[model samples]
Target: MYPKVGSPKKVTMKWLDKAFAPLKDYLDAHHPENAKAIMGWMTYKGNFDDLYCYENRMTQGYIEFDRSGQLIRCSDNALDHEYELGYERIPVKTESIHPNVDRWIDRTVSAKKADIFREELRLFLQHVWGPMANYDFSDLKANYPLQGSGSPYCLYVYPSRFSKMIAFQFVGDEIVEKNCSLREYQKFEKSEREFMYQGWHLVTLIREFLAFEPDLSTTREVVRKGCEWADMRIDENTEFVLTAEARRMLEELEKEESKK
Candidate 1:
């Protein structure tokens, strides 16, 4: 026979008094309007570890409001602090170095991964050349035909805006090479060789122009796609070279997708 199961018991405000009195007193003294609006309370139990495990900890508390409303505040009992209800803005002064660019450059320099660095450069070029080179967006066309012969590079052309074509030579959806050379559909070559050579790494090319560009929608999309493609190729033995911040951003993108 199955063991007897008890019906759930509803918790009342009186029960909450033992635990939330300090929080109540705080709100009563400071934000009385918020205090008066409280209708019910809830608690969360979880485990926390710091070198060792601590179980059955009351990790959080919440207050609910009436009129089909709620104002929730979670407490970190261990830290003795409440989470902020609203957002705060902290101003940072603009710097010459882009965070991603700096991190990528540092990693590349330290790892000495010249081939991976070059591949990243080609990917960056495929994305930002249109905007950085000031191509007319309205005249731009997606997935232009292949242009070159011996190397056979695919072109993402923006004709009538300029004579130069940004050639992205690919190897099975992965961009293997890129260049700004004139094609049969174009007239003159735009000299972007200095942009490529002056930089110690691929990030310098991006930091020079793309970072300051007003319209970076295309660049953002292309970079995200490139990263996704790279992620698919990663295995246990593969050393993923993206910086911590970049990995965090990618994780956030994954979280957003999961929510959807």
Candidate 2:
């Protein structure tokens, strides 16, 4: 079994707490209109060891929105099981520069296995988050295609005057127009139809852009698809999808982050 790192160092907790202190203080001081949303996440209940374990299993890097609405980044610990995955329950000693050389061969083997797992996980995360992890959204202009009457295929043409660009598709000369919005196109309602609605999907995409603050290409792609999906018009009889334009953009967004 790997050696334990003992109790967490006070300094580490201090730094961690300090990381969220300001945001927590902000919510306590001047409450914003979304104060409820922000305040609800102020306290985190998970153990770091367990948290790291889950993160490792998911192969996700330790970047998450903390309870205080602050961002915490877990650096890639390729050699440590817990660090690599984001959980802390591994039997191996973590944060220890010195390992028991008495069992050098076994420790070395365990470390190697751990390293392989970490590499696989890192690759998975890179594929999932994509170029948006590296790019910013301010660089791209909206270019949603105009869906003419009755056509199934849609495209992005330009930014909208209001929150989103509106596009139309047609079937049998019947014109179907969809209006798009950048944010909050319509107030959120609690119906399954409304929740699963394309408009909500667009809003989610916008939130993703703002949350990650990805690169220009990534941002533009997100905004473009968002606009395209927002413009799609669906009816009781209309075959509805998330939209190819939107899916393509999302695919690019989920491409490998590392150029290599």
Candidate 3:
């Protein structure tokens, strides 16, 4: 719940405007009804009488104007309308900064990177586990490489329907250690093959890094396959082996990923 009216805090119109600006044309074109409705409602007063008063109403005492601007004994319809319009205008801000913020940086991906990798992973999952977990592939599209969290490469893997969270972090550009709770895993019955395939797929994906450096000549080789980062644990279980070139690429990827 938001703070009550007159709570002595300012609503960030600038931030909200910036965040929601990108959606303006989109909203206007696709959702003109909502756009027109909000525009029409903006003319009315709202519950917060002080904020949404008419230009003339400013001369009158702030409280004198009902939220709706019409001077009834207990009417602030303008303010109420402003509140509603303000709420509707919110999405303009959220859609703007979302892309540059790397919201989709490290979410999920297609099963096919290379034919071999895809086939191998599919087989590994299908054969290894008797009952593979189901998931929404679209979630992969939202893979955000979040900072100040566990591991450099945080992946949202679904080990089971009930045990969906299997956050994995990279250890030294190689190993991808999982962040599953022992209790959660114990509660769910998974085949040995499922566990092995998950581990193998992660390693294989990491090892396939290319050099992603700005200047390919001076820095180590860079790979631009996938990018996301999290504050992952570095431990024995988190290590994987890569080609010397791939290792160099991954180390650089880690540094670049951190900057984002």
Better of 1 and 2 by lDDT: 1
lDDT of 2 by residue, 1-260 (tens): 11212233232555444443544454456556554454332332233542211122223333333444443454363112322424333222123212222132233224433332332222212322224334222222222232222122221112233343332111111111112111111221222133244353332222222223233236456545765566444545555468889998877877854453
| Total colliding residue pairs, candidate 2 | 29
Q: Measured by TM-score, how close is model 1 to the native structure?
A: 0.18
lDDT of 3 at 179: 23
Error of 2 at 112 (Å): 50
Q: Clashes per prediction?
A: 0, 29, 44
Give lDDT per model, in order. Answer: 0.33, 0.32, 0.30
Model 2 residue runs over 4 Å out of place are 1-58, 61-198, 203-214, 231-260
| For every candidate, C-alpha RMSD to the true structure in Å | 25.0, 25.4, 21.1
With a 3 Å backbone cut-off (N, CA, C), the pairs that clash in candidate 1 are none
Cα-based TM-score, every candidate: 0.18, 0.20, 0.17
Off by over 4 Å in 1: 1-212, 229-231, 234-260
lDDT of 3 by residue, 53-77 (tens): 2211222222223333333332333
Model 3 has an lDDT value of 0.30
Instruction: Give the per-residue Cα lDDT of candidate 2 at 8.
Output: 33
Provide the lowest-lDDT 10-residue window in model 1.
Answer: 46-55
